[model samples]
Target: MSEWQQRSLASLGNYENGFAFNELHWSEHGLPIIRIAQITGSQGIVDCFPGVLPESYRIDEGDLIFSWSGTLAVVRWSGGPAWLNQHLFKVVPAAGIDRSFLFHVLQASVAEMGKRTHGSTMKHIKRGELREFSVEIPGNECEQRKIAQVLDTLDTAIRETEALIDKLKAVKQGLLHNLLTRGIDPNGQLRPPQSETPQLYKESPLGWIPREWSYGSLGTWLMGKPKNGYSPQEAGEWTGVQMLGLGCLTKEGFFGAQLKLAPAGDRGLEKALLNDGDLLISRANTRDLVGVVGVYRDIGTPCTYPDLMMRLMPSEETSAEFLQLVLQSSKVRRQIQGSASGTSESMVKISSAIVTGLKVAIPKPDEQSVILCRSKALDAQLQSELQELEVLRAIKAGLMDDLLTGRVRVTPLLKSLQQTAAQTGA
Candidate 1:
């Protein structure tokens, strides 16, 4: 630890929960009410609630707000007056303490606070507990300002890199949608069939596909579900068998990083061992998330799926990657949501029967191969961009830890902070 002073969070600021605003008082236009959902970052706010509030409920510029539920983070003012709701805690820093510095301290301690949270269901932070939390503050105001400036700069960089990555991904998704739905020929023209032959496009179980295409369900092609059934035991690193759960599947596709290793056991469902090119579809989840699909490119070791996921291995005619994309499309997602069954709002589940009945469009083998190759290339490019974004994010997180903790000095940036303050004052 650096040579610094320590103080409870209460010493620096008073924490007070916002008042409950009635639904009847809300209107489309008026003072934007700030809620826990709106306080997402250290500085300023985005996605404000479009509700009017009494003038007395307004929070002034530069006041900090922290979320009281789910995720906790300090909210900075963007030079505007706003009203706060019950799920937020406003922290008014005492004179002489930099609000930005306090925000950074609270953010850096979020991980520790999360671990300390106690609850069987929804975890939360009590005001008394938060007030007692201690933080190491720099010896002087100059030091505090320097630290906040450095961390803020790194955060800005990370945000910019993330934005770039998102734009690139959007571009790639657009390409995939176009390439798969309307293929490109050697001449770079859409491979639409001749206009004279309207029958060239025929209705299949999955909707209209090329006339010569076939329609089939995933069950028709898969060898069978993975043999090993679901395991309740926590996974270990050295365990030879790897088990893929719902976490491994992302909205875009399979995220290899989410795989966990399972210890060998006689969990009867072992027969469903996964292989390269195998497709996994989420079988149980929210209406929109259920039936999400991903193609397995590599399984480092033998892996089995939980009962909540369905394994799909296409027969000779269809490409696994092609089917994976088809399953992930908006049209297929709607079909899955429409087919789901459940009584409770939170218990929607898609059964194997529903999955087997899902209709898929299949093109000729050669065209399937073309579509698969193009998609894989685009996926590779997207993965590269995502990796780069992850690296930038890691750097920013590390910088935040060091800067906020006072382990790294930012004296060199003092002039920048002063200049920023001066410009804003002017």
Candidate 2:
């Protein structure tokens, strides 16, 4: 066990505000700059060549930065070396402290400060608030080092897991192209390309596809007519029933959306009750996300959708998974985009007329079942990785809350816990 000392952050180092370089200094070439946007995780950066301002404005990878206004976050800059813009505080740690440990402490502090922030229009913490914010540090630097290392290990795992998910998604994207185009032959392997089996492939309005596969509008696959859902004012009370928003549509399929509870005994309600296996598409969203399709998984509670989305109850013969995969394919997405993709601040709405008429090449009923099984396998892989990522994130949050806040001691159990954590992840 080790004793901890309390100290104000201001005593540790200078809280230098990022340089407020003029627009004239901005350039296309030279050091990319970190603005408040960059600090809040927007990748866009403004480039400023050297000599634009004094040397004190630059920040390196791993340097701790705090965005004090608008949005609050503590980030260890991992991007290329860049200039620190205004409205940000770059803490240059003083001697006798580890930067990694200080980073975790500062992150916890910013989050706590954000909760206590005061403002009507825009919440912000005065410099005095941050200056006097107290922090606890182990008297033994070695213990602080171990705790940071442990947390960093968890952070690294989280990043790697996310990276793996991204890689799997890339693979899935490629898989989708092949699965939808060539499809699984009776042998359960990807069918040969058009070049290998020209007899099996033919040219259509949508391009080359398996000869046995048929092309038709999405409307044909629906068991019942496609219809838009009802949108109404959010339920006046929290205790009312749930209504769905466009936010419910996920790339994987229907995940839950913002829970909008309707007022008790509200009108215009009965027709909109969402049923299990209902395929949903967003009629209005950002350009990139417009026409995103998903299947609704009934959450065991009655739910209804809004007018910004379309629900297509698939035909009895059609596999919901197969239809969703087709809608998500790149070619079909391009058609959806062609109909309504635009550069507008207002939401770009995809009309049911355009979406329902989307052309797709579909396999027979038996083949769709096989494709569904294969697609589910891919989804299972991605979902498994995502689940692990969620668990690692939970573990890291617990560590930061406990270890950084001094509620849980990591010193005595450090090595044993480290070994256990090592066994569990990459």
lDDT (CA) per prediction: 0.71, 0.81
lDDT of 1 by residue, 1-426 (tens): 455878887788777778687776566665676766566644444334465545445688878777767666666756477778786777877666787888887777777888888676766788888766898787688777767777777667777877877887787777766655555555545556435445656766655566656667655655554222375565655668777877788788887776666766756536667788777788777776777888877767787777788776566766667778778766667888999888864558887777777776666777777777777787787788778778877876887776766676677446666799899999
lDDT of 2 at 56: 69
lDDT of 1: 0.71
The C-alpha TM-scores of every prediction are 0.79, 0.89
What RMSD does each model have against the real structure?
A: 5.9, 3.1
| RMSD (CA, angstroms), candidate 1 | 5.9
Cα-based lDDT at residue 14, candidate 1: 78
TM-score of 2: 0.89
Tell me the deviation in Å of residue 243 in model 2: 2.1
- Regions of candidate 2 where Cα sits further than 4 Å from its true position: 37-41, 44-53, 116-124, 195-197, 236-240, 341-344, 418-426
- Model 1 quality (TM-score): 0.79
Least accurate 10 contiguous residues by lDDT in model 1: 40-49
- Per the 3 Å backbone cut-off, how many clashing residue pairs does candidate 1 have? 11
Q: Please, what are the lDDT tens digits per residue for candidate 2 over residues 320-413?
A: 6678999999999888877884568367878878877989888889889888887788889999999999999998888898897678788655
